[model samples]
Target chain A: MSHFTETEIAYMQEQKLGRLATVDAKGNPHVVPVGFRYNSELDTIDVGGYNMGKSKKFRDAGRHGRAAFVIDDVLLPSQPRGIEIRGRSEAIQQGGKEILQNENVDAEFIRITPTHIISWGIDTHPYHPSSRKISS
Target chain B: MSHFTETEIAYMQEQKLGRLATVDAKGNPHVVPVGFRYNSELDTIDVGGYNMGKSKKFRDAGRHGRAAFVIDDVLLPSQPRGIEIRGRSEAIQQGGKEILQNENVDAEFIRITPTHIISWGIDTHPYHPSSRKISS
Candidate 1:
């Protein structure tokens, strides 16, 4: 059984857009917003759009064996709640029709199987500065 | 000279965090939030945490050479102002005592070099959704 409550997974799936974090060749963190689809049945998340081998981010994923997918914003800064999942990537082709086409990528799917689930929604910050510091 | 404006870089640094787009081994898109540092002098961005290397998000970065980083939120359905950077990642280690104590990152640094920087601010959003779809 999964550790995540159905409500938690639902909350994530409901929000279609999230940020994908990757590593550069130099070990720097690179981030970008993207659209994703979570396969509730398979307990997997699907993400794609960049070319299989040519894209820089795709290449990084192949090199690095881990990554994080995050969603949600902290409105009050003091009360920051969000979802993050860690998983490995495996390239694949899906669908006969293309949804959104970018010159760099024609792949239909990139799936992630999460190992950890972190939720920081509770009031853990004692002050705004501390919360603000972590939120940014 | 860099194509990004001073204001843009400042905005990026101030936020200090972004959405990370990485491709999983399965060709799925993985999005996550990451804390980052931008060095204007070298025109590079760095991201790493003690346990970050173990995260799924990082694994995806190694898989996909092309990744995007986006800052700013979708306040209104129609107005989305953020910067998406296309780049590559190479792992580099700057061994130091401080790296071991603070970040737990024995390597000390990871860097990303940008090929294209896409700045989409309030000026670019058109009929975009106000709510962000969350995922894991």
Candidate 2:
């Protein structure tokens, strides 16, 4: 069974960009916009970038092994909707091509196995968020 | 002089939402989509939301006193442009109404005083990022 609900998966599919947050060695959080995809086979959120191997976020994910990813957008005038995934992250080499599929993409990426999820304005009421924990 | 360049400030003014990343007591990172504005007077990033006082992100900002914020969007075909601000953060009370100007807004908010900044595709070449540190 997939860890994500149908509505969550659909929402992820509709979005092309997300903000990835990783913690540095000093515990300061860093966030940047990146290209991401939902890997149904692994049930993970895979993040890829142009030069992923040398990126600070890639290094941070490798060192800390944890991250938070958010995909959100406004609907029409004022409706805000999105998903937040906090999970175990792994910086993997030679996987960027598979995830991003861009000719200029590097061969490195970050994979997040979600442990907690909070989503709003998709499957539930616009302002009411639904959260759950996935026990590994 | 302002910490943000004119181009950066203009870009911020054009956007109404950003993703805020905050660290918890356990060093776990949490990110959520939020409504934010560039405060010219204090030269800070002020984040406001509905029921802001009780949100986990508000509490996280209070406990960690550090955060990362990102505002990004894709332009037509494929250009991605945005700014990332990492710095000291504070959870403030009785200020949300002034910041958000919404009747439903709570009287609490998070304020970020930027210490580091990274921006791409705004003033510089597309995909080429410029970064700097702000000395207090």
Candidate topping DockQ:
2
Model 2 lDDT tens row, B15-134: 988999999989999998888989999899999988889999999999999999999888988788999999999999988888877767788999999999999999887778899999
Cα-based lDDT at residue A47, candidate 2: 92
| CA shift of B77, model 1, Å | 3.2
lDDT for residue B126 in candidate 2, whole number 0-100: 70
* Deviation from native of the Cα of residue A113 in model 2, angstroms: 0.1
Q: Model 1: how large is the Cα RMSD against the reference?
A: 10.4
Q: On residues A1-136, what C-alpha lDDT tens digit does candidate 1 reach at each position?
A: 5545665676676675766666655554556566676666666666665343455556666666566677666656434556766667554555302433334445555566776666555332311111121210
Quality class of the docking in candidate 1, CAPRI style? acceptable
Query: Residue by residue across B1-136, what tens digits does model 1's lDDT show?
Result: 6556776777776685666665656554556555666666667666665456556556666555555667766555535567766677544445322432344443433455777666656334422312221121
**Backbone clashes in each candidate structure, one number apiece?**
99, 0
The residue pairs found clashing in candidate 2 are: none
Give a tens-digit lDDT track for model 2, residues A1-136.
8989999999999898899999999999999988899998999999997888999999999999899999988898878889999999999998788677676878999999999999989998778889999999
lDDT score at residue B78, model 1, on the 0-100 scale: 36
| DockQ score of each predicted structure, in the order shown | 0.24, 0.90
TM-score, candidate 1, first chain: 0.67
